[model samples]
Target: MEFRQVSDLNFNISRVTLGTWAIGGWMWGGSDDQLAVGTVIEALEKGITTIDTAPVYGFGKSEKLVGQALQEFGNRDEIQLATKFGLEWDDEGNVQRNSTRERILKEVDDSLRRLQTDYIDIYQVHWPDLDTDFSETAETLQELLDSGKIRAIGVSNFSPEQMDEFQQTAPIHVCQPPYNLFERGIEKDVIPYCKENGITLLTYGALCRGLLSGKMSKDRTFNKGDMRRDADPKFQGETFDKHLEAVEKLKEYADKNFDKKVIHLAVRWILDKGIDSAIWGARKPEQVTFDNAFGWKFSHKQVKGVEEIVETIVEDPVSPAFMAPPE
Candidate 1:
């Protein structure tokens, strides 16, 4: 496993972070606790030291499971517990952006308790709360940093301008943006801003929520609770077929040229794009194979080839905006 250092952080994050949203079982139907625990421990044993989760992910279930896994593994200091806050949920599973000072104040302690850690390595704002002043959120995170409740601050799904406003009060050390083979929206502004500002980029959805995993089939169906069945437009009718076509071509291209799977190519593409890390979502031990994602990269010509394929094939491309919660 490869590691990269983020600004203002004491530890190095794995180049491929373990995303536990699936294990949270919120949007992707349901999850098994034993499987989730096995998955986390397997990833850590395989050298994936950074695990990303959000309180809203399964409404705190993912953090609790990760905590349990870490406890069993018994190596707290070796792992980086990266979790998020600011999105409040209800008993019925409805969520809204709520980054108020009060929300952060309570969420931090709750996350620490669930994660079984006193301090989070990277605590992020899951989304920007349009109603709240950016300073209010930033000030609270600064206090957390000072109090040693969190070692670093991060922001997700934030516009470049919103980050600028938040930075006015506190410096951001890491930024989480949905970035992958299909979701290239952040490459325009967010990626450049992070590079120029010295903030490490830990991009999520390395497989485009299993689209680029190269294991999905047309006849395959998701459960009723699966977010892709409804929340994601790309999984519907013609849009889904178009992406599958691109995936097929990309899969063939990777196997023919690099002798690697599309999953490897997709993740390597992100790392080669200069991203500090890529969040590889997995819910099972077998899905945690990211060691091959490193030690290789797409050639410059191959990168352009990939763009040409996607831009030409997926005429009605979609981003991850549909999954964002209400403001």
Candidate 2:
């Protein structure tokens, strides 16, 4: 339940943000609306105030569910709402990036309607559209800010170069990227650039899409719709086995240093890396319980130890090459 300022924006958010992609059920498996609603309620009760969602997720189904859950809880002002646009989901369930000025304007209106909110606390471009001019997208974001439809605008899955290009035209308050013990790509440039520019680093995949949990076995199989089953490189064949081996080592460190679970150690490790917030994509209440066990305090030695273990196992310098294209 520890809180931190989301950059210098004068607003405080919980260290753990509730990620709504699981609730979207677009690429993940076994998502129940009631279960997702219960998880959201439980997260708010447990002091998690920030909820992250995207319009492309389930082609707006996720935002609708989030709106219903918020209305059911009746605590809109108590929570910090964040969602993204720019990724379009066509009739065939294909995802495409569209950051054109016209598309951005229409998407913001659509998102606000689905979210049941007039203004979003944090509105981000889900990915960079290289085909469109960065300045064009920035201008549209500025218009949204001026119109009060969005309080702040940020970018997600953007490289250091893209961030700089967009920031030159508009103010950015946050940066959301995949950053975890298994994915330290942000350490190269994105994180340092955010620090230098006073942008908050809101990290997702803090569990490496559940790789660091030490639960999935080598023979584990995912449902056909489970996107990571086919999309994640680490989840395929020998890479999956190697990933589990690394998690075993992390478990040893967790056992020796503290009584927390491996997942808690994983989360604490990310927070210790100077990240502004860690987004948790917990579908069940039990998952939340595991994440809540570790809070704001970790010894410097322990932090260093976790880093060393990850580096030793992965043996790859964190790089932006793993980032998916805007689509």
Q: Each candidate's lDDT (Cα)?
A: 0.91, 0.82
* Residue pair clashes in candidate 1: none
Candidate number achieving the greatest lDDT relative to the actual structure: 1
Instruction: List residue ranges in candidate 2 displaced over 4 A.
Output: 290-296, 316-327
Question: Candidate 1: misplaced stretches above 4 Å?
Answer: none
Which 10 successive residues of model 2 have the least lDDT summed? 317-326
lDDT by residue for model 1 over 1-327, one digit each (tens)?
A: 888998756679989999999999998999889999999999999988899999988898999999999999988888888999999978788898999999999999999999888999999999999999999999999999999999999999898999999999999999999998788999889999999999999999989989999998888799989989968988888889889999999999989988889999999999989999999999999998788887777889999998888899998669888888998
Candidate 2 structure lDDT: 0.82
lDDT tens digits, residue span 1-327, model 2: 778887667687788898988888887864888888888888888789999999877788888888888888877877889999888766888777889999988988888888888889899999889889999999999988888888788899988889889988998898999888877867889889999989988888877778877687888899888866857778877777777888898899888888767888888878888887899887776677644445446789888888888778777533334436444
